[model samples]
Target: MDIDWPLLTGLIGLCGVGLLLAYSASGGDARALHSQGARILISLLLLGVASQVPAPWLHRLAAPAYLLTVLLLVLVEAIGAIGQGAQRWLELGPLRFQPSELAKLAVPMMVARYLSDRPLPPTLRDVAASAALALLPVVLIAAQPDLGTALLVTAAGMSVLFLAGLGWRLIGLFGALAAATAPLLWFYGMRDYQRQRVLTLFDPERDPLGSGYHIIQSKIAIGSGGFYGKGWLEGTQTRLHFLPESATDFVFAVFGEEFGLLGAIGLLLLYGFIIGRAMHIASQASDGYGRLLGGGLVCTFFVYVLVNIGMVSGILPVVGVPLPLVSYGGTSMVTLMLGFGMLMSIRGHRKLWPA
Candidate 1:
């Protein structure tokens, strides 16, 4: 099978930059650097294997796989391990996993399967039902209080719905309703920390040294990076432990501290290339399932980039969103690579059978 070199090249480029940023962010710490290196190597292998799986296989397994993912999520809640104040993972002997990662794949499968070739302009009922289906996993995820991942999964589902020709008036009305509900959700539905994030976002100096510290320091770090940065390992904000989650959610701040605007712009361009290739592959898909899966994955990936930069820049409240390909997490990497692999498989084997 022919490989789409552009996708592979883009992935490689991202992994390469991720490694450098990870290493530098750790202030030259050997263990963190090596651990990140190991993740990159493993991700490369996963990407290769994922690229090899035939699209037909993914299509056939779509329903069962989605059901399996839901079951896994249930199992996680029932008898799962807890970490960082959230019961969002399952612990095996040597493998701990987040089932929500599974939703990234499953949600797209279900949506694509539902909307594929139904009709160009879906009725109001169809749209409402699809919206409900999209929100199901999103609500389950927010219960974990992992707002970042939930938002990305929501984007994945919405991409499919949007591709199904959702009308603008409905979207506008939904936005208006969301705006109307924001207050009620804040008072009745949100947790204390979540609300404080929004409050702190508006005026971080209110509690400049406590809960607000992260956003303030992150902004400081990005500005500290200046036009050319402090020359890599010379960043004071990260090395001093001022920015929270420096290895993960706040990696972009560290990235800014070391790379400056030029590097930041370069990183954005890389993301653009990755998303562009994903869309190109989605366009090449031979079936509706492939189209939905491929398109949904690319859109989800775009959400990661946008959310991370937005939160870090203080335009949006901090929401635990990790900068894609740069954050230090095995689960996020695995899920992302899995998506790319499926995209590659769809592109490579678009024809030649039950696709």
Candidate 2:
């Protein structure tokens, strides 16, 4: 097994925390625990398989994988299962998975492969081409009305650009352009509920029992935990069902409420270590493809943690981003673990491939 021990250990630790939180959040439901456990095992299996694959193979599959994912996204738009008021999943009989989850890996992989053979600090033409590659799927996903996943996919592709030595001036210009279009996006791009969510972030109390309910309850649950938490299964908010999405997006709040500040910090430290280790692997990769792909995947993973923690902690709008391994979900677990697997592959195969 050519595994990266530190990274794998951190992942397993987070998964364990997830199981603990899931059990508590579900009020000790055996079925929920079993299902989540099964998913974790499957995700780990995929990670193991991915880690064994060579970097060159990943480089070869990048374009095809990306194209297939985009095709799936289009299929999602045409004939997809609608869940939670969004068309994001594609159900093939007993198998139901989110194509957008695949985008998280595909977009970055495709971008990294494209830029690898090109010059560093990609020229205007190259940047435009890369942006098109990213935007195509992003547009398709946004049309699915899955703004969260769309934004995440965008971030994943942008990370590749950033890692490819994209200039600071270009980045600043892009930032300014995004800012300038914020109003247009607000008025024309955002749905009513999405706008409400953003507004609720500033004043969650405004809707109290309505639009603000989730964040407001999450804040109370987290705040009541104080420094040492209320202890496992003793969380009033979770036990009494005051908290919503306790087993999914808001699971972190349940964790904070049960385990307190110390546990939260410990969990974050574990996450930090995994991210740091992945970055170190990326830094040591002998090829541009390996470096960009590894770095981009890790950056996307960082954003996942940031957005989920930010939303649950009342710092950002609730965009339905799960708390990585700790949140109870299947596709997300698989996608993230697969990314880690690819990182391990990059590290494990460094000596075999020349720069």
The C-alpha RMSD of each candidate to the native structure, in angstroms, is 1.6, 0.8
User: How accurate locally, in lDDT, is each candidate?
Assistant: 0.83, 0.93
Q: After superposition, how far is residue 117 of candidate 2 from its true place, in Å?
A: 0.8
Per-residue CA lDDT of model 2 for 1-355, tens digit only, reads 7998888998999999999988999999988889999999999999999999987999999999999999999999999999888998899999999898899999999999999989898997888899999999999999889888888999999999998999998999989999999999999999999999999999999999999999999999998998999999999999999899999999999989998999889989999998999999999999999999999999999999999999999999999899999999788999999999999999999998776
**Poorly placed runs, candidate 1 (over 4 Å):** 353-355
In model 2, the worst 10-residue window by lDDT is 346-355
Q: At residue 54, give the lDDT of candidate 2.
A: 89
What is the overall TM-score of model 1 with all chains considered together?
A: 0.95
Off by over 4 Å in 2: none
Best by lDDT: 2
Candidate 2: deviation at residue 277, Å?
Answer: 0.6
